[model samples]
Target: MSHEYYRRGKNWFTAIGLLFCVMGGIVLIQQLLIWGIDFVEDFLFNAEFTNEKVSVAMLCFGIFMIALGFRKHEEKR
Candidate 1:
């Protein structure tokens, strides 16, 4: 029973992570095209929450979640 719960949780994590990754990727690409790489540097150095920053955050978080889900799945084996 608990194993089933874990499996579902892992699936959810992976699914949500993928969604975030896609959304972030789309936004990041759009921002990059509009503002170029210089904007990325600005966002990194500046203490502001811009679309690029949010997208990067989302991308990082998504990757972390995906790794967590996969790690859990492997541990179950």
Candidate 2:
């Protein structure tokens, strides 16, 4: 396939949206790691703490924004 997705756009939204997507993905993954650690702690030490709802919501929102940004590119082609 062509490299259209990587091509730069004339506006700022595409870059910002991509950044948001990347950051959100990182946050989500970090939360996953934290959840895993908490799980281990709960199993071994009886500690209890796990909450990723906010991160999950932000990740989904970021993905939506990324898709919205891509609409600009699609319109240009």
lDDT of 1 by residue, 1-77 (tens): 66556544437777888999999999988877888989777986797777777888999999987887676444535
- Model 2: weakest 10-residue lDDT segment is 43-52
Specify the highest-lDDT model's number.
Answer: 1
Candidate 2 lDDT score relative to the true structure: 0.59
Off by over 4 Å in 1: 1-10, 73-77
**Clash count in backbone of candidate 1:** 0
Q: What 10-residue stretch in candidate 1 is worst by lDDT?
A: 1-10
Candidate of highest TM-score: 1
Model 2 steric clash pairs: none
Question: What TM-score would candidate 2 get against the native?
Answer: 0.47
